[model samples]
Target: MSGPRMTVVFATRDRATLLPRVLDRFAELQSPPGGWSLVVVDNGSRDRTVEVLRSYTDRLPLTALSCPQPGKNRALNAALQHLQGDLAVFTDDDVLPEPDWLVRLRAAADSHPEADLFGGTVLPDWPQPKPDWLCERAVEFSVLYAQQRRPSGACGFADIFGPNMAVRSAIFAAGTRFAEHVGPDDTNPLYAMGSETELLRRLEGAGHRGWFEASACVRHIIRPEQMEERWILNRAFRYGVGEGRHYAGRRSVGLLVRRLVYGIAARGSALLPPSPRRLRIRYRDRWLAGVAAGRPAARASPPSG
Candidate 1:
């Protein structure tokens, strides 16, 4: 309660059953240097999320904001105006932070006063064992919110995931908000998933420094439905959609043709891998196909100004 004040923010929709546990986890977190509080944005949930949040009112230092709008970014942007700390830390409703999570983040912030962006490690907390096709590769597990594990170090802004990231209040004060159109939305079917990525990239492009705090760890829960092959593939397809959107500014007919050829070849080679590697290859191939599938029209339409 004596260092830098921090505000932890997250947005949730219709996850009432799982929210109490998250709040419980937040209760266990050590306060950062200047003291810390929670701000949760309820993004138009029809379920008992509001009720559950209200239940935690006295137990934790918390504020609940109602965002009638649907997008995750929309809720986050709304929460920004209500933040009461110098540091605004972002995480998802489903993450469990280590008890020392904020302590480590605060340490890094105090140690590196020049950095405006901070990223932390995210490890997957699966409800069940992972299947064989999805081998345990920390570097390749971002799909489940597992960020690359390395010693606490510096990294690109694009490497910052939404589940465990923080930014100085000054950055928001300078007028940066999460991209409205491309993030997770309860009502939107597209699910493009890159609002944080876009925001960090924008900040980095403008010369903001970032740091990665290895000790600031969070366990992202992987539910049973997410373990299913169909769901995983669908997530890959959405990732591909993000890829398409990312390239919208520079997409060309030639680039689209090249993507088509590469995708076809990748699919053809996918038919030949042995069983162990076959599923993985197929997953990648499908993701590539999705990229190609989304590229043509993306290239045809001019990017928005």
Candidate 2:
């Protein structure tokens, strides 16, 4: 039997210099039996992102869309109406998929008829002469880099991340859209994270089953700037904020006390030598602070399909 058609979706912003390599990799992808198409959404980019995308129109099966909105989730929600085929694959502009990426995902979908959601492995594409701190805490900081740790097989919603995941098209056909409140928003420096995780959690809550396709993998480019300690810690804080928003209703006195304790410990760790333990503590502390802040009160109205 032929495999299901796939629609690969991703939103990019101000990555003009890096997008060409990513698109070049996409051009080399081996099409699955059911074929595939790429949808690239330019999310309010102020750089040469538009020109870069247009240059790739002839090299790949690409359809470019523009969403002047700031949030990553809002840009993705806007692409829902253009989605076609049996599966909607999500990834980022900085990721490089293997030639057989879609083939493996399609095969996994064919093998697991019961699963509606599919997650692929995400490995890091580290910069050369990696920083010592990153080398030491690479495994521990996998979550921060969107790296997948789960073994291939049945998995939970938490196992699926934005950099590499897919879901049945029918899910969107039924009116399920990403929550626009969370995710990257250039307008807000403190915007909530977990754009994809929030949606996965909701799907699981509604009884959706997920699968892990170990063979289908992508390498998420870890830019040199991301190697900086400050950038990593900022990501940690945003992650905490995302988690806090995710579990907003479950907040309690105990959680508050824990956050207080973490704050003190994080400050104390700053005086110590640079070590994995100290970095871990600082990361956790920032995250806890974000959790305490919780979700933002003013949310943009969700886009309609």
Best-fitting candidate, scored by TM-score: 2
- Candidate 2 structure quality by residue, lDDT tens digits, 1-305: 56668999999999999999999999999999889999999998999999999999999999999999898888999998988898999999999999999999999988998999999989888887665556545325556688786679999998887888999999999999999888999987777788888899899999999999988999999888887778777777777777778877774568778877877887898888777777777777776777766645624221111
In angstroms, how far off is 133's CA in candidate 2?
2.9
Which ranges of candidate 1 are over 4 A from the true structure?
136-139, 251-276, 293-296, 299-305
**TM-score of model 2 vs. true structure:** 0.93
Model 2 ranges with Cα > 4 A deviation: 135-139, 295-305
Best by lDDT: 2
Whole-structure CA lDDT of model 1: 0.78
Task: Provide the clashing-pair count of each candidate structure.
Answer: 3, 0
User: Candidate 1 lDDT, tens digit per residue, 144-250?
Assistant: 45554667877788667889999999888878888887788766554665788889988999999999988899989888998765566566666766777777566
